[model samples]
Target: MELDRISNLENDITQKIFSYLSIKEAARTSVLSKNWSHKWIVPPCLVFDDENGLSTETIVSHVLLLHNGPIDSFKLSSRKDLDPNDIDQWIHYLSINSIKEIIVKKRNRYSSSYSISSNLFSCQDLTHLELYNCLLQPPSTLKGFGMLKSLHIRRVTVTRDVLEEVISHSPLLEKIILCKLGIRHLKIDAPNVSFLELRGGFEDVELENTINLVEVSIDQKRGSTNSSSLLKFFFKLPRIERLTLQDSFLEGANGSLPKKLPEPCLCLNFLSISIRLNNLEDISTAMCLLRSSPALQELEISVQQDQHVADAAEVTGWLNDKQNRPFTQLRILKVTGFSCVKAEMDFIVFLLLSSPALQQLEISFGRKAVEVVDFSWIYDNQNNGAFMQLRLVKVTGLSGSKAQANFIRILLSSTSTTLERLTLQPAASAKELWELFKLLGEFINRVSVPAVVLEFLDPSNSVQESDDSSSSSDSDDDIGF
Candidate 1:
């Protein structure tokens, strides 16, 4: 029961506990007993960061010279001022010791980045590699990574030939992430890759072969000049199950729908589109994708604020096409930044009428509507049994107007047998948030649907928190290898 008895444990168990401590912390254990004098010299994983006052070169060299065991993971983080030659020697040493994984990150953005040392590529035992803000130049005699499974490169400079050589050579490569890189064209010929993400623009991306690809995400540079290649790249990939496209990539493809719809992507199940909503063309391009994916089960849309209002007349004509019906497999639709424009409401009404199998609709709107939408179409569709199976409806930033309130009431009453939960997230800003909270009672009193629960969300804190949480998770995933 005494804390002092911790040292009395078996030697292997004692060393295992010390492995969790930093090198400096492990070294301090020497003072407790002579049995631990040189025990800290080699305990497996080696991680050198800026927390220690000494330079990365000094700490890494000191440990590598004294360490005796094979390293499972080696991570070195430093500012731009660290000596490149020393890094080369450390990696060379790691190669000889059978290092399994390596991570190198540059902490300074303005400083020059170190070109990766070629000797490290000789580590045939390595399975995962992550590099940030570095230059990559594979060795000329490169035999390709034989055992690598995951690779993440961010802000790294490497040519299309080198990247292709790396992927084509690695027989076991499965997951990869390329972000903020300098490249004009990308051609991947990996056969076993399942998850791939590209966060920058390239003139072209030719997927020679990725038969096992399951998830893909593309976030292009804003107003990218090489947008034409995006659509071509999308068509080339083997049918992926999940796809995410940011506004930066979509802006280039706006209003550029092909004369005939692309081949039906039966494998697609989840699709996410983030658009700025600058015009009706944005909406059209998104719908074009939806029509192509007749089997999509979930759709998420984020509408960024744009100065221009949607042209109601033109949008109506676009949706009136009879061919746009029968999104037969769609079940969930999530929309963010929903401003109550006439055209926007019309778009939602079209979804209600078309997505007969739809089970959930979640919308997060703005503080004020530019105009009151005539949603009498909802009642007409409900009377015709269009939403007989709809189960959940969530509306954020609810308008205080009687008409919008009535829309919700009628929507619930029509689907009362199936509807379970209705959630509302009010707009940001203190004044509007307060007004929504005060008006919550008036709407609750009007509800008549049995067993239907109404829930209000305080987005004042959640809106910003959720965004930050998402960003942090993405960063972690970039290094999760």
Candidate 2:
């Protein structure tokens, strides 16, 4: 009966196992039964976290004794007290055994320097290497790893010359992520790099040869004074499909070039951008960039000031100019976190009038300072042989006021047939909401066009009253407005 059970256990252990125990604890699994004696010999991957005060030398010796084949991956992160030599020995042993991927993390209270020896660079099978808070001597060349694809170095000091050498050697390299490397001048010549992420202090990075690049993300959090150098580098990105700029301290006043100039005429179909325009001068610079792209279908703009609204007329004129035709293919337009003042409202009206094919329009008001404007002229003009094609209008976070209510009434009155959906969330009682929905429904039924579907949603639904106590929370609350 025991022999049959052992055979059954062997058949049951077909899947791989991942464990976080010390090597000694892992070896004890051999004593579970005869079928498990050699279970620890051929783990596809080995991960050892020094949690139980295991010495690095002891761990390295145990790993050498157990690992006989090429390891698919090896990860070692030690925080306890251990000799640096022992850690170096473990890395050396793993490199000799042809480890394909390796991650080494050292967290000592005192700052210690752990250098990656030249032997590490000679690992021909290594495809991925990640190091955290470790020191690396300048690599002569990364030519040893002929198949290297991804390399990440964070919180380390890599000189510019060494960085250039490594990038020059990796012919098939696709992705490189660098953080806090203290690199002052970065020059990349790799022709096949597809993705590159650079963060830390402002460094003058030149990407003159990445022809097949698709995405680039730069985070400049160090508030460096070198704004012109960075802006020059940003404008030189030739064909990048996606670009993201975050936490840049070069607000236009500091003599930095306008953030919007030198725009790349990329075949970009989607764009999400945030600009810190402190004045109209900066806004004009940004408008120059917006005018460069006439094919954008979806646009999300988050402005930092309310005064930029005055530039809306110029923006609208730029869009409708015969030379710069409007984005006739635009379907969705969203503007958030700006007071819908008269200038902003007029800009939106301009877009609505220009974009004859727009289907959805969403404008989020920042505060209750400005009164909501009624854009019924768009629909009324359409009735007089105008060619407006709007279908849905949504106004969120509605304050119970006359201006907002009148805006809703004007929209319902204007586009009764073409306006198929209207979503309103008002801060009012359920009975008040029911009355508004009924009124709107009757108005739509009287029209010869299709009866528009008007939906009135209570702005507050999370107060948690009992179903019986809350008459407005019932299915009847969905009645047409």
Candidates' TM-scores? 0.82, 0.62
Q: Ten residues in a row with the worst lDDT in model 2?
A: 468-477
RMSD of each: 4.5, 10.6
Candidate 2 per-residue lDDT, tens place, 1-481, comes to: 3356543554225224434445567677778767667766656577766665766558667767776555777776666545657666766777778778887765542456576665677677778777666667755445535667778776666678777877777777788877667777888877778888776664587886788777676655424535446656555556766554444333322455543455644554444444433334434444454455555566554434433343444543443453334666667776554343434443455556656677886654343334446444344333332224668877655544444444455555555657777776653332244555555566667765554566666667513222111112212112211
lDDT of each: 0.72, 0.57
Model 1 reaches what TM-score against the true structure? Answer: 0.82
* Clash count, predicted structure 1: 0
lDDT of 1: 0.72
Please, what's the RMSD in Å of model 1? Answer: 4.5
Candidate 1: 10-residue stretch with minimal lDDT? 465-474
Off by over 4 Å in 1: 1-5, 8-43, 51-54, 322-324, 365-388, 393-417, 424-434, 455-481
